[model samples]
Each structure stands twice: as C-alpha cells, then as structure tokens.
Target: MAVVVALGAFLMTLFGGWVAQRVIDRRHLVLGLAGGLMLGVVGLDLLPEALSAAGDDLFGVPEALLLFVGGFLFAHAVERLLAVRRAAHGAADWGAEPGGPAKGKERVPQVGLTAAAAMVGHSLMDGIALGAAFQVGGGMGATVALAVITHDFADGFNTYTITSLYGNDRRKALGMLVADALAPLVGAASTLLFTLPEELLGGYLGFFGGVLLYLAAAEILPEAHHDHPALSTLLCTVAGVGFIWCVVGISGG
Candidate 1:
C-alpha cells in the first residue's frame, strides 16, 4: 500500500508540477482556477470528512481535535523554518556588500523550499485521509483519492507557479519542480507511522484543515481578488465550487 501510494503521489506531483509550468505565465486565469479548485477541495473533500468525524464515535472527539492541532503546528513550523532559512540565505548571499556579484552567487529559492515543505505536509495529511477512508470502505477510499488528486493537481499547479515567480530562474524552478515531486512520496512513506496517539493525529488533521482553510481564505483567495473586481473574481470562485460540485455529484464522492 505504501509503495503504491508513494509511486502514485510522485507521479501525480511530477505531472502536476510540469503542467504548472505551462500555466504559470497565465496569471489571472491560473489564480482564478487555482483558487476555485482549492475551495472545491476544502468543501468537497476535507469538510465532509471532518464534519463526519465530528459525529463518528469510533474515531473519538479528542482524536479529531489532536489531528487539527497536529496538522496546524506542523504547517506553522515548516513555514517558520522556511522563512528563517530564507532570511539566512539572503543575508549570506548579500555578504555585507553593496550590490554584490549576484549571477554567480546563486540566489537560492526560499519560496521553493516553503512550497516543497508545505506540499510534503499536505501529502502526509492526504495519506492519512486515504488510510482513514479505507477504514470506512473501499469505495470511500477511492472517492477520497479522486478528490485528493484533484486537490493535489491544483496545488502543484499553483505552487509551481508561485515558486517560479519567486525564484525567477529555470534551475530554481527545476528545484521547485523536483522538490514538489518528492513531497507526496515522503508523505506516503510516513503512512506506517500513523499509529501515534489518536489525539495527536486528530490535532494534526484539524490543524492541517485549518491551514488549508486559512491558505484558501487568507492567501490564495485574496491574491485572486487583488486588482480584480470582487464580483468578477467571485464568478470564478463560484465556478470552482460548481466544478467540484459537478465532480462530486458525478463521482458520488
């Protein structure tokens, strides 16, 4: 199961990253589309399960709380680490000089690092969702994968673009590409370790859900709204939700 998941995630990451490169240059369309898809993932996949988890006694409430917290802390830590790493890298690159030689200096990618870290965390959470889905039923597990892949694809598309915009170097872009590619495999490999305390897992899940929600509302959606009219941007937003609605309806997810 782990190997299959690893391979699947890697392949998906590669595909998503590569396709992202093509659309990175398309700013408005990409942001709009990315925003919508993100909303869909949250509404169609994560929310339903999280809401259901609230009612299911076998999973336990404490466990659910832990999952949210764990995921949130993990994401927060990764973001902080990446931010620190970026600052250090920049300071080092500057080397106490005015307009130091930059071309050969190899300006490293802070955003790419964050993107890779974020996605790995994302994939690990998805792996849990996948495992949890199977606990319910085979059909539900497959359904979760379908929804997750949709999310992952959009995630790859946007991260690749955002990282590329920050990096401004094909080599840096490639690093983002490869790093994004590995995140899911890392997540898949960690599946064996899911036996940690239930509350712990619950905290992570809830926290991660919050991370996704915050990202969608605070970061991704606002970016989409900037300089664009609210209503026009909203149409795309609804379109994204509508697309997911259609997918869920068709797939019975």
Candidate 2:
C-alpha cells in the first residue's frame, strides 16, 4: 500500500521535470511555490513530529534539535566543499587569467551533480518517512505521504534545473530526475525489510527537516526571488503554504 501511494509521488516528480523542461516563463512562480511547500512541511509536519518522537536530551538540547543542527551544518559543509572544488578547478582551467572566460565549462556539472545527488537522497528518505509513518498509524502515514508527494514535484524540478543550470547535459539532468523519481519507491519498499526506532526516526526527521529548510530558504527561495520579485510570485508562495496548511488540516481530521 505504501509503495502504491509512492507511485503517485513518482508520477508527480516526472510531471515536475517535464514542466521544468517546457515552461521557462513561470520558473520563478514554480520555484516560489516549491520553496513555500518545503517550508510548510518542515514547520508543520516534520519538526513537530520529530519533537514528539525524540526521547531524550543531548548536552541539554533535544536530540532531534541536535540532529537538526547537525543536518544544517552538514548541508552547509557539502555546499562549501563543492564551491571550493569548483573554484579551484575553474581557476586551474582558466590559467589564472583574471576574468578570462572559463574554459572548462564541462567541469561545472560537478556542482549540479552534487546538488542533485543530495535531492535524490532526500527523496529516498521521504519514502522511508512514508513507510515509517504507516507503521505508526494510517492517518499519520497518509499525512506524511501527502506532504512527501507534494514536495516531490519541487524535488524533481530542482533536480533538473540545478543539474542543467550547472552546465550538465540534458541527458544527465534527465537521468538524475528519473533517479529522484524512483528513489521513494526504493525507500518505501525498504520499510518492509526493517523499521527504525522511534527516537532514531525522530532524529532522522529533524535532520531532514533542517535539510529541506536550508534548501528552501538558502537556495530555492533566493533563486525564485532573484529575478522577478513580482507580487504574483509572492502570492504563489503564500498560496503554496496555504495549500499545505489545508492538506495538514484535512489529513489531521
């Protein structure tokens, strides 16, 4: 049943990537909504659940919060390392000529590959969340599944856009998009093999919440607002959050 539900997410991800390929005009709007949806999930779903499930404190902080910080820093480190590597490689290729047009554009794919890989990892975790939630209760599982399914569209869109934006070939970007789409299915299936402890699940949720929050605030939202900053885009973001709120409400009932 969980796998069946994840199939919906898989389709949504493919649709998102297709939309990204076809629609350039509404990029900001799409990104805005995606960012908003991510924010809503972290705040309204993941964090609360993590807090409730986390069992104890670590160094006077909740274990979930500690994992949250760890996740944030972990993502920050990954980005920084990728940036440094890109800079060094770019400079080497350009021969230290100040502002010389970067010669080895091919190397730029590394950045996108890294980012897309992270998104794929997150999607897998989303599947695990679905399975774990079902183990707890049907209502909880369905709610988590709804959030994961909705957020996955953004995952697919960002996976393609980030890969292409970083100079990867269309084929590579599409490949990653397909992998991201399939990851949840794998994760959901894995749940049948094993279950995580509640405390550990809380920690994982906190960690992933931080990851999604960072991506939404630090990456996606900024990119969305970078060019247009129009009222319509802002409204799209608001509507995205409102949509999630309704989903949460309905699922809770």
Q: Which structure among the candidates has the greatest lDDT?
A: 2
Looking at model 2, which ten-residue stretch has the lowest summed lDDT? Answer: 84-93
In candidate 2, which residue pairs get closer than 3 Å at backbone N, Cα or C atoms, i.e. clash? Answer: none
Q: Per-residue lDDT tens digits of candidate 1, residues 1-253?
A: 6436546656666677788666533444445655676567566755555545553444455444455556556656765766533432353345456667663255456655565556556666666665555444454455455545555665565556556544556776566666665665566556656554443333444554666655566555665565454576777777877876776677566
How high is each candidate's TM-score?
Answer: 0.61, 0.81
Which regions of candidate 1 are displaced past 4 Å? 1-12, 24-27, 54-115, 138-143, 158-169, 189-205, 227-233, 246-253
Give model 1 RMSD, 1 decimal.
Answer: 6.5
